[model samples]
Target: MHLGQLAQITIYPVKSSAGLNLTQTQIEPRGLRFDRRWMIVAAATGHFLSARETPQLLQLLVQPSEQGLHLQAPGLDLQVATPAPDGQRQVSVWDDELSARLADSETNNRLSDWLGQAVQLVYMAPENQRAIDPRYATAAAQSVSFADGYPILLLSAASLSELNRRLLEKGRGALSMARFRPNLVVDTALAAHAEDAWKRIQIGAAEFAVVKPCVRCVLTTIDPDTLQREPDNEPLKTLIEYRRSPKGVTFGMNLIPLNQAELALGMSVVRLA
Candidate 1:
């Protein structure tokens, strides 16, 4: 709707876990480095597992390491090495079937025991390519990591403010921005849902195409800190009352990088198209 500014940048080194903030970072085609590069999947079925079903994943905190990534949770901590593409594992994310680098049996066992379910932490190999949905992606060949469908999820601060206002009016407590889990958070002043109309935008030196309105899911209903659901599922249920579309009830916008780019916090966001 008007001029906006990038207020924060967050990276989820592991899928569906807590994200770590950064001052600045390179923007790869897939996403920021280590962003959703790793995910926890079912050992038997090899399907992607996330906070949607196992809220325990939300308790893990991510940190980038020289060897690979570091993960810390309530009673466990893991330092995962970057796996070679040699260990092949067929895994599925949504409709995209891609080969992922499987972790060692020990790592799998530890994670499985901690979650109380059989699961393995896998990495996206260089050869692994999960192509973005061509219908929304700016380029047909663009690929992503373990993120739902796009490279980035951008949310506006004004949007959360509006949602909080609605919750307050309804006699419900407010929720935090972490509930939505975005890669980038922009301050749109007072324009709620302004990002919905953005086609393309420049954040500092980085150019991103706003591909699609991100659909809200069951995962959004979980509390990031407690890893528990709100008794009312207030925000999501409230969002559905007005934000539903033919596609789904949506919240933020998904973005795809236009070229090699770098983004930092406090950058001014300029609409390009």
Candidate 2:
């Protein structure tokens, strides 16, 4: 049965940085190709940095290239070649500790200057296997890139529309879908929050298990456009009023791909369970 059409596909090549919208992409075991394959970490602590603490990261635009990534921020424009795998370094992403390849010192210095803080850009090579949380993963070997937890996050347009409706009723302005930063946005005819009940779904040729409801966080409160935090935490504050759960205030669904396939805009989406 047709539940919706794939309306948007976004990949954050560099975690917490601006995302790139794609018309089509290949789905790999970790996630869409190059998705969150790179990340910025604090120079001293080797801990990951995200828009949650430094909203300025959102202003950094990253574009993948044949050679590596082209990053643009404020007055800086840089083309960083893919770091050699030999430059392995230990980095921490929340509770996951993994090895990542460090970019050259030149690239690191430039980025540090741009952010006004010492930071390093690191790449997650294919060999760096950061396993998903055991309880939610379908397989013991299931791995994720540098994403918060899951490989993919799926949200329905109807869900955002419903949220907007509630925001409007509260005299708050509507928010953009970018605020949620989903990898897949399905335009469905189903009622708001209908996706909360979906256990499995097929998009284009790929099948996915809806492993968990994505817990909302402070990152969602950051305005993608201006790279500023909402004074009153409008949507998140509003979401807390009703979307709260034992897991936390939730919005989108976290997914683990069951197979490799391609996803394209306008592809038919079917709820499998």
Candidate 3:
């Protein structure tokens, strides 16, 4: 079996916000602790908002706290409560309408004002569950946090190298992996997009099922540094030339960890199945 090393780990404590890279992380079914546990939702419709629409949401910096995550932007800062809110609100993300705990009004108010919109901060209570799309799952019933669907997203450095190669060939600058915002990055001596065929992989002591190719979206077009979409419709436009699919243009693999374990940088990534 060809072996690889887990080169990096990242967690998005709040959905659509910036991600925090870690040399080590806790692997769990609901995803790394605080990963996408909180999300911003539109108050009027209870529908979740993402950087896909609110590119500015990318500007929100997340700092974890014992109480919860501390959010900062421009000149604003707010400490969100860690405990799930007592009041529940039904929020929709993609095809799922999940039960989410509403944040305190003050936190919501401040964030809404900062974003110049009427929105609310919400948390995914443990009791509330969203199942993964079963066709790709190994378990009869597996759940996820507030992530788009799966518990983890994995990418290989070679894949990025290949994509960058294509982009450079077209006179475009290379893009950063941050555009994909993966949870685990593997440095494997495999061909580009090899993860597309991996049924399962082991990182440290944790086994993860490589479920599906993550469908690319407009949010990827947004530069993490500038929070602005590429004027040329770039990477996405280029991706369509090669990565298009019936489901959508896919750029990375989504994973579901099978057990709890601590993963650290430079850990071996062994293909298990």
Candidate with best TM-score: 2
- Residues 58-82, model 2: lDDT tens digits: 8888998546999998888999999
lDDT on C-alpha atoms for all candidate structures? 0.87, 0.92, 0.87
After superposition, the stretches of candidate 3 with alpha carbons farther than 4 Å from their true spots are: 83-85
Model 3 misses residue 144 by how many Å?
Answer: 0.6
List candidate 2 stretches off by more than 4 Å: none
In order of listing, the candidates' clash counts read 0, 0, 0
Model 3 gets an lDDT of 0.87
Give residue 22's error in model 3 in angstroms: 0.8
| lDDT by residue for model 1 (1-273), tens | 336888988988888888888889889889887799999999998899988888888888988764777778987888778887789799999888989999888788889989999999889977898888888877778899999899999999999998899989998888888889999999877579989989999988888899899999888888888878888776789998889999899999999998877788888899998
Q: Global CA lDDT of candidate 2, please?
A: 0.92
TM-score of each: 0.96, 0.98, 0.96
TM-score of 1: 0.96
User: For model 1, where is the 10-residue window of minimal lDDT?
Assistant: 62-71
List model 3 lDDT by residue over 1-273, tens digit each. Answer: 656999988888888988888898788778787789889999999888899889787778898755777888886887888655579989998899988888889998998898889999888877888998888778877889889989999999999999899999989999988998998899999998889999988887988888889998888889989988899887889889888999999989999889999989999988877
Q: Give the winner by lDDT.
A: 2
